[model samples]
Every structure is written in C-alpha cells, then in structure tokens.
Target: MSVPFALFTHCGIYEARVQDTFFVADQPLDDGNGNPPAGWGNPYQSGTITVTGQRAVFHDDLGHTVTFHERPGATSFLKLCA
Candidate 1:
C-alpha cells in the first residue's frame, strides 16, 4: 500500500477528494479588535484536523464530530469511526 495524498492550495483551500464529496475546512481569524489586516483578516481556522480513510475529523478547543462516508483509502477511517 501507499500513503494517502493531500494538497493544500492557496486562498485557504484544502483539496482532499476520493470518489464522493470532498472536504473543505476553513476558519476565520480576527485582529483582536474590529480592525482588519492586509489579506490576513478573516484567516481560516488553524485547528488540529485529520482525515483518515472516509472519516474526516476536526478537533479544537471545542468538541468535534466524525463524518462518516464511503471514502476510499485506508482502514483507519473505519476503526476511528467504529
């Protein structure tokens, strides 16, 4: 077998597709106050995320959820979700 491949493109976008729907994770960041930064404002969320097999998981200071699907690739998806 081989390790899965994932690519993160510019403009705060991550492309991880298999056969069905793709996963898109984006979170915005503030400048402490209402002020904005140059192309820095509204930055995507930088949290710990993992997509093993068909289960895409997102974890942060808050709770997280497991999205189940027939995502092709590895067995971790099942074991993780199961």
Candidate 2:
C-alpha cells in the first residue's frame, strides 16, 4: 500500500515507507544538541522502505534488510508537518 504517511517516527521510532524514504541503523542517535528524537541520518538516502498495514520494512541499496519496529508516540503532528 502506498501512503504519504511515509518517513514517520511512531512513538520516537522511525519507519520508512522504501518507496517514500530510507534509514540507516548506525547513524547518529542524535545530532549532539539534544535535538530530541525521530530526526536522524541523512535526509536523502540510497535505500528504500515499504509499509504494509501497521508494519514497515527497510532495505539498503545492496538489498540488505534493516528492520526497526514502530512505537506509539504521544506527540501530535504540526500543521506544516501534517
């Protein structure tokens, strides 16, 4: 299923929808300025993500799978971000 809902961080956990975006596990946990969470790695990447129902799958450029689960965040979306 395709969704504009890609590139989301559910409860502080990042999920890429591959057709929408990507994520790297070893990337910095934070930018080093208490940037909080959900924001990590390069905004542009080589891999891709796929989302099915409540589940998401990530794959690198080399076809390597990088899996991360989604958690429910209490935060709401801003007008601009939404």
Candidate 3:
C-alpha cells in the first residue's frame, strides 16, 4: 500500500474514525504527568498507522507497531489511552 500522509490533531481532527492508516509526524509530551504546553502538535511520529475499530495502530519507520486507544471527546482535544 502507498504511504499515507502525516496527520496531527492540531488541524482540528479531534474525534473521528480514521478509516485508513496515516502518520502522526511527531510525539507529544506525556499528558498523564502534565498537560503539554500550547502548540505541541501531538508529537507521536511520522509513519504509517492502521486505524480501525476503536484504536489506532502506529507503525514507525522501523516497522514497529505502536497501538493507541481511541476515546470519545470533543473535536478540540484528545483523551489519551489510560
């Protein structure tokens, strides 16, 4: 499959089903410890991601699959997986 474009929550992509794979492009700070400072565009990484069901699987450049949970929330913020 062709590589998907990078996607970040910054451009107001808060809540929705990612019907396909895409890249995160960067990684944000650990929100569990404290809130990320303003303008921290979801610093995950830039790579392939297979988003299906209620989760998003991130495939790094090295082909490592990192899974993340998808929660219901406003279109402005994302509730990290616990």
Error of 3 at 7 (Å): 6.1
Q: Against the hidden true structure, what lDDT does model 1 obtain?
A: 0.36
Which model, 2 or 3, shows the larger lDDT? 3
Question: Could you give candidate 3's per-residue lDDT for residues 1-82 as a string of tens digits?
Answer: 4245354433333222354322232343334445333443453335665665556665556454445566444243344432
Predicted model with the maximum lDDT: 3
Residue pairs whose backbone atoms clash in candidate 1? 27-44, 27-45
Give the residue spans of candidate 2 off by over 4 A: 1-44, 74-82
* Predictions in order: lDDT: 0.36, 0.38, 0.43
TM-score of each: 0.29, 0.34, 0.40
Say which candidate scores most in TM-score: 3
Per-residue accuracy of model 1 over 1-82 as CA lDDT, tens digit each: 2223332222323233343546533432224453222343133323354557655544434342223333344333221110
* Clash counts for all predictions: 2, 6, 7
Give per-model CA RMSD.
Answer: 11.9, 8.1, 8.0
TM-score between model 3 and native: 0.40
Candidate 2 local Cα displacement, residue 36, angstroms: 19
Candidate 1 ranges with C-alpha deviation above 4 Å: 1-21, 24-41, 64-82
